[model samples]
Target: MTTTLPRVIGPWMAAAVVVGTVIGSGVFKKAQKVAEFCPESGVALSVWVFCGLLALLGGLTIAEVASRLPKAGGNYAFLRDAYGHWAGFLWGWVDFGIIRTSSIAVLAVMFIESLNNVLLLARLQYPADMEWIGTGLGRWEQVLATLSVIAALTFVNIRGTLIGGGLQMVLTALKVLSLLAILSLPVLILAFSPTSEPQPSASNFAPVWPSDWSQVNWAKFASAYGSAIVAVMWAYHGWLNITPIAEEVKQPQRNIPLALIGGIALLIFLYVGANVAYYTTISRNEMLDLKGTPVSTEFCRRLLGSVGVLVGSLILMTSVLGSLNGNILVAPRLLYAMGDDGLAPAKLRQLHPRFQTPSAAMMVFSGWAMLLVVAVAVAKETSWIDEKKNVFDVLTDYCIVGVAMFETMGVAAIFVLRTRQRELTPLLPYRCPGYPIVPAVYVLILVAVVANMFIGTEQRTEAKVGVGYALVGGLVYALFLRRKEA
Candidate 1:
């Protein structure tokens, strides 16, 4: 019987996991909403920078905790250690049942759905738009694509963290290289391509605060910022995912913190550069008014012509695929941890005798994610859910509040542990630079952001779903998990 997971992933590979998981479809797809939120080019760019900072702070706060308690279930272990078994159990309950699994499902959906744009650009047709059987196979091409990636990744991870981590490093390297190519090729083409039109004026950056603020309802700005941050925060969402697999990271004592911080720092630079690249070429109006689905494709086309579509699509595909693989690789460890603690089904703790990986955990996770993909497709086909909402949007709604809420909870644990230092074993080898203030400010911002998710916009309705999921998790914890513990 397989009794353990190996700690074989080095710092570079671990940082790749953080970068790979965090840099998904959001950056490629979310600029329109960000522009819509900011009311001006500067404001929009500020949102990106601000969200990046917030994410960086979160990385710092979580890093200290992660290094101190390097384990399979990243948040699960930290929460239990700082808060108590009940807090940890509740987080694990919701994370496994909704947060992490739905996140994986959403990434898979984004990957397959985005592929449609690439296929269309090639003048190729797919069965994605057609019905297979009573919506059979549920939008055949996409469902097949989603299932194929999910299955292949599940098997890949079942091979062990090293193989999975290695796969992530390759995918992330390709993604980063591709992104650099996309950024550079455009400027080079603009330099040589004959164009009478001038590049975007520096004046666009004027009114960084938006000159018309007095003309607008200040209250509405909160709502707009709230909405935009939701998307922006989504772009920054995967930064801490590296921590969940900390136990498998070589030198978790040192590497986990480095990966978490280094990854976010890298993302901040990438995100700011991407935004600067887009706005320097495309106007806020043009970006907000884009007819094309992905703002990246259109932005690319402006610079690279028709070839931009292919570039944009490939970039998105690589980004989402890398993120999808990272998700599949790390998310199962949460279940394995829970199972080892006797809080989850014990079977999940079993590793493959030969592969020596969390085979059962990966299979269980991917199987549920496949169901979510199919259910979303079927719901779309039958019009059972909102016509405007797809699986990704619905899942986002179901968990966005919980996502922010939990991040805050995790950060607050830093203080919780400070008081309980005696509770720590060997004690943390590292600590956040500013200590209390770093985590303090981070939690304050999270509270404000989470409040906005509920009180500020039409999005409030969706946040209710997240609340319901939490309540249900609480009930399950009380009824079943608690009883088992007793």
Candidate 2:
């Protein structure tokens, strides 16, 4: 089997990948979840802003490292350079086995679920007695759709990162533009039609605590803010993925850093803007009391009418699809990297003769993703857990944990790199503005999030399980895999 490396992605396309992956289904869907914790509109907006800052800080640090190293494995490359082969291998293990795959699975499910909602609503409006339209598809149908989505994206990715990267840019732009249009229209309408009273509810624009600071729940404040950071950080997860394609980037030492910081700043603005728009059009109380279903989608329905609902649903579907595409784009590169180093089966290192892509590794990843979809579908059908807790819920839990693990380790790597690698090239092009301070602050915030994760064991049991799985996987790889390599 011959090895075929992908062409370098340029700065603009690299930025697109970061934006595309970071701004996916989570932004549209997770607003309701944020609302659950921070009911006050101002608080929610603040949370979004703060999360953006954290993302910015993390991105800056990653940009510095990526600029310096400019490798394909991203975190894996960072860890290997900073620490040792074992640390890098652990990052790869989790990324390939859990983080990327689970994320793709969850997004794929959301894509199907969002589409289902749109179809059901269309049926309800036009054909009053369309039973099949509203009815949930059987397990097999879901598995098929999930596989179909993965397979289609997998084929695109196998063509090479150039095509994949280009498609991601277009889809990302469309998704962002659609969201902004959706958000802006209602505000414009309300401004023009002053007589139209938007529904009243909790103070959407008021501060959660009075200016005096007397009413603050210092304890709950700490906890709520910490937990909110966890959610926000999760939403801001993909800033570091740019490093994986660093080798493909033109003038990576200069462009990778710029792309990382610029991409994250753009995402922050969009998230904050979108949330503010949501509050401006809909009241905080309505957002908070949005029961039985998610509020973000409902908010879209109320703002746009029937057409709005379909458009919002389509936007969300596209968002998830982009995220899935990103996961597929980056994850296989890890397998290829690992195989190159003889950490995994070398056959995975094989590149296609014609396509110049990792054909073997791509197939393996697609098959694994399909299997996960089947396992999840079967689990849901069989009531493996209470029907109340669906497979979607379980997988989301697993993904969060996996992501948290990577984040915690990745941030720690920032420190490790500073201390261990003295001989690396002089920092060039971009540097984290605050440097030691910014990275240090990010590490502290991450620690606080992990502490909060432990505190809310009941709510975040899945997160705990995810951590356990990561630790176990790391240990196993270190003992069996790493030792053999050594």
Candidate 3:
């Protein structure tokens, strides 16, 4: 059995991991929240564009960082090499226990929700009372379905990263084509068949600015814009995920940068284009009014009725599954790196004898994610929460502040590592274009976002909770894991 993971992922697959993982479930769902916060089409579009640009800056900055410390753990490696052992341990700790696992659970639940849509469209329903040992979970069928997907994807990734990467490429292609269809179909229908009923109209683009712009309160607007930016950032969250598997990429120096910059450029285009298509198809006011149905589902339903829903749901399910696969493929490598560093159980570092993948790490990550899914279900059923949030909302809110903090720190690591470049082993082949300015700007914006999250009423509780979770990791490390270093 080889102890090393093979460098099997090429440039294209690496890029697919970036684009595919970031696009999942966000544009379809979070756009509504963005629209609600921004209201005006122009404001919402600016938020999308602004967030995309920040993400691109982040990508460009991280490219140099990844090249300098090319390793399996991505940001964990960066934080460790740049700061110290405990910094890295905290990232791995929060990531495994909160961020990444919660992400997997959220995506799995979303996939199941899309599946439910398909079934409902087909007039098929699962047994209403699919009890799970009489535990009274929120919805047993959905919960079980979520676990099945997380498990299945874990198995696929356990087979090999190449297989997972290949699957990501195919799903990425399908999702891109699906998004293109969503972006183009409305215009095509209106252009070639102007007499069609319920066709997309030019008027949907009106009121580009809010009617109350003259009376707007700058303070309230800033808060709302900050909220919208966080949501949009979620849509852009996975851009750096590809870096986690740097050890498995064919040429880390070349491929990782290409993946980072090129992938983010494409994502910005696709995201903005898809949102424009949605707003034009369904007016801004209508989008704000939408409650249960996602904006994408509504756009498709309007465009092609029942058939469109099926198509949209299938596209979403595939997109989400692709993201899930990418997450599973990359996240375990972080745990493996942590184990290799003695921050986690040593067993997590073991690779599969035949597959050369982090089998133990994959199982642990997926199992925890499944547990989170169960936790959400039980919480809801037992009235543990005041609001009627789904697994996705609850988990995303729980982890967003932590994600923002780490991501900011990861980018900021650039400055610290630069001064200590001689001590770091690998010489960087790629340098960030704007150096101090690029990373500086990205860090500042994220700092503002994190601050806003703490200030805003809705996100304040979650932000505190997320920070508290990370602080607890510090306690765990000081008491137990820190002994390993001794």
Candidate 4:
């Protein structure tokens, strides 16, 4: 008999998972990129808001589907059931091997890197001479720290869903409070004391539209807008992760939808408000040129001097840790789902006897992520690699095309199941708001992002990689399934 995971996560923890996972280091890292692409505070902020709306639309639609079919494989389950088993299998493979596992490595790297920032503020000479992945930055130390954290979290989660839920709650709470601090401190300093060192001027919000928008060059605008959207999309990426653990959620019908929508709504508020705080401290061009210095660090440096720098680093560490935990928790469940269906190695389907957790799958997933970390570290020094892009950026972009494409399928599954599967009609306890139009818009935007990928040179790297990844996944699945049958 197959062991089953217990329904231990409540509405609040589920929602916290949603919030914590989405608001990672990207908000701090990519806020500047958005400014680089859009430049004009008005257009830049508009892009952020527009992306939030798109995320919400996608969330609401996904919430409906998740509620209808609350299962472990969330996206994989939806795709398999709606399209075909093969469709879901490939998504699982891509997510496990590339998108999600790389995200874990990246978030862990960011976490350790931020922790290093904290140490530096304390006048610590720790890792002063270590440099393996990059020059003079203790890249080797960062890699070790990242792997240790991932290993620790994996063990904590190995206990069961209940323990993981508890850890998620605490991390999410700390992350949200830190973000609020980022938002509030700037406005507070501006409100109370203006005569102080560096305060935001009313002039920072000027030139509300892109300086080049008046020109009729569609190519430039598309490139700029697409790049900005990719950055924003990075921030909005993990809201869907909540659905993957839906089977472990108590009252999955109500909690799933509430967590999905509420978490994203909260994200919208935090993302936009955080940028307002960022712009309050740094001008658009300054934001663009902030190489090596984290945007949050620069913001905090301007606010509380030395103390703010430590605070900024701590905040980033907290955020990345939360995101890392969420990714680790979600990906194994996907493997468990696939394995349960005979689509993956049978060992992945085995749940721990006492814990009822997908312990084997978690280890497998972590092992893969560890390999990616080493691979990225190696790629950082390789001559053929793009000098401008780091391992995180390259890995993230490689999956961008796959993520956007799969997201469209997941959303469109709402439309697919609602019409094609008569039996599932009764299962949809929560109907998507706005019916066809809302999801249609979500899918259309994703379609545009995929199309935009082809048009932009920088984006083409990820696009070509994504296409090749999908094709390879399909080819591998066919062979694997054939071997199983044989």
Candidate 5:
């Protein structure tokens, strides 16, 4: 039986996973929320830059731990080695159960949403009219589309990481190039013809600070900024995605660190640039007026007219697909590692003889994600909440709190690992640049986000649900995994 995955992924592919997994639906969709929270162009831009740096700090700190371990489970290994079996198991448990699956579900749902945008822009609809299927939710078509995407990507990843990783590289390039084209659209339009109607202007950035600063309530500003940080966190959510497949990465000590840091740095630039493009082409009031519509769609409409919306929606779909593929490529490695340790089903450790991939784990993860997609859609149709939040919003709100708690602890493991001096023999290949300060700040910020979730009214119930879901993993550990470890 094949017991190991091959180290066929190179530095570029590794970097692509990091960049590709993160640059998903957030930058394209969440800018409107950021603008809503901040309501001032300057403050909104600052939030983007600030959150990007937060991801950078996280990447920097985790890179050191990854370099030392360079194992299959990434942060799973970090937590296990630094803390204990319980800590590691909880990470993997919550990961497979909620965080990772919710991420995939959200991406797949977003992909379908983007497709819907394209159809709406072109004035088309699903031909079959399956509205009778699920209480006429009118979303049966979308749920089916989301399921189809999840199934397709799951099969692609199960073939092998080489195929998956290569696909990721290509998709990453396409998305990055597309974003660059977007940022340059205004310049291109003006250069070709100076008399364009909605030309990009520097004046759009006026009132650099909130105009009514003295009149502003300091408490309200702090609350709004905190909420903005939470919104941007979803955009920068997948920084550690590459680490899970560290064993599959060639020269992991060198490549993993480079991928983590460099990928985040590039993302920082692209995300900030994208926001600049959005704000420069339109006023802050225009962005606010979107009223839940994606700001990018309108930005494209202004620049490319009707054709621009189609192109932009298609680009966003591809971006979501790249992220979905990247997540599928790496996430199952955690399950595979868990199986090897007997923390999960032994079959999960089994690799496909011909392809040498974790087929069982990949299928299980994808299946659960598809179920979530359908369940969320059904719940909305049945009025699970009075407001009727979409699948994307519900999943994101339900998953972020658990993610924040564990990831914060994962970063803090650097301190513990450093103190224990377990793997410092050869002098680490990469140490986090700012050391204690960097990791400390990263941990502190996430802790603040978590606290705000509990204290604030908007997401309190979702936060409670997320925590309860994670604790359910703890219960499983006590009943099943603890005996196996002993």
Candidate 6:
């Protein structure tokens, strides 16, 4: 039986989903990592901006594709139409098994951790020896909080798309406002505080360039940029989420491009502005010292005192929570799409009769996500994995590799669609702006990222596991799932 769904999301709603998804845990926590590799504030800022431009270009290309094919199963639909069902099935397989779920779980855990930090700070005046609820609720407490948030949001999604969309919109506004406040705080404090240092002179404003090309190993620099791109691209990754709800968007063709491009532009501005603010107040050395430490909160505390710490924590929590919500909102549709294709159990496609939401699909997703959270948390608690390497880093390494594989395959799909369907070309509403050149550049950058995955000492196992998972996913689709469907 065919179901008719409501067009509850418009351009703004779609944009909010994209922005909310992209601005998650990365920005709040990843700057120090970026700073670690790039060293110079100017270089770090420039790298961020460059990543934004890359994201913009990728957005432009995908927008053109999305406008042409406004379907539920984003890259899956694109691959299916361009290549065949086998390719589409593989795409969906990787998406469901690895990329999307891992991302959501990682972000959710981060949000919980951020909130826990805020709560701990609030209770700081309590006697140091006193315990609120045995061991005083640290990381494990954060996990429980995260799971609670996930459960609540899952209920919202299962209840109805309208409620889910509304929550997204509200949270998106809060997140943006929080970011603006973050950017403005240092300037405001400098203006009002008697102890604030004077603004630097013009010479100080000049961008720092790396000198001594001999000291800078070109090979090492290339490898580092490649590695950095994985993190950078992850930060910029979710612009494509808009396409999943394309059918639910009013004027899908026109609005899809606007949402994708607009969201990327907004993120670009905020990222650059925030990084500039970060550099202005804190020395490069300070940012570097805080690498992989809980020092971000401490940095804010030093700059704005206790008030700043609270504010920063609130902003980070909201940012990650909004991001988790965005993921929850979009991920179930992948399962629903698979069910519709007869690749997955038909039960997953069932929509709530009254709410008109994918209740079954969302439930399955939430269950799987909860399992992942518990598994990772248990591993940490048992000391099976080092607490120093968080679940976020581990998942990111896997996701980066998975996403790189999909992106590589996706870029290839463009050429395949062009060559295989020459006669159907006139029907496409949008086309890539720079034709071969633009897509070619995207492929080059993606290749660089994949190569860089092997270069880094950190997160190497995660990267290997990611690649292994993708390969196994492809094999599963080929030998079992694809054959059954065929």
Q: TM-scores of the models, in the given order?
A: 0.92, 0.91, 0.94, 0.94, 0.94, 0.92
The local distance difference test score of each candidate is: 0.79, 0.73, 0.86, 0.83, 0.84, 0.75
Minimum summed lDDT over a 10-residue window in model 1 is located at: 129-138
For model 1, residues 130-201, the per-residue Cα lDDT tens digits are 333222223668888888889998988887678888889999998878666655654665577646244444
lDDT of 5 by residue, 183-251 (tens): 888778879967877888878877578777799998778778887788888888898998899998899
The clash count of every prediction, one per candidate, is 1, 3, 0, 0, 0, 0
Error of 3 at 8 (Å): 1.0
- Expressed as tens digits, the lDDT of each residue in 147-198 for candidate 3 is 9989998898889888888988998998888888888988888889788678
Cα RMSDs of all predictions?
3.7, 2.8, 3.5, 3.1, 3.2, 2.9
Give model 5's TM-score versus the native structure.
0.94
Look at candidate 3 and tell me the lDDT of residue 244.
Answer: 89
In candidate 2, where is summed lDDT lowest over 10 consecutive residues?
194-203
Q: Which pairs of residues have clashing backbones in candidate 4?
A: none
For model 4, state the Cα shift of residue 11 in Å: 0.2
- Which of the two candidates, 1 or 4, achieves a greater TM-score against the reference? 4
Q: Candidate 2, which segments miss by more than 4 Å at Cα?
A: 1-4, 124-136, 195-203, 210-212, 288-294, 387-394, 420-427
Name model 4 segments beyond 4 Å from true.
124-137, 211-216, 382-384, 422-427, 482-486
Model 1: lDDT of residue 480: 76
Deviation of model 3 at 246, angstroms: 0.4
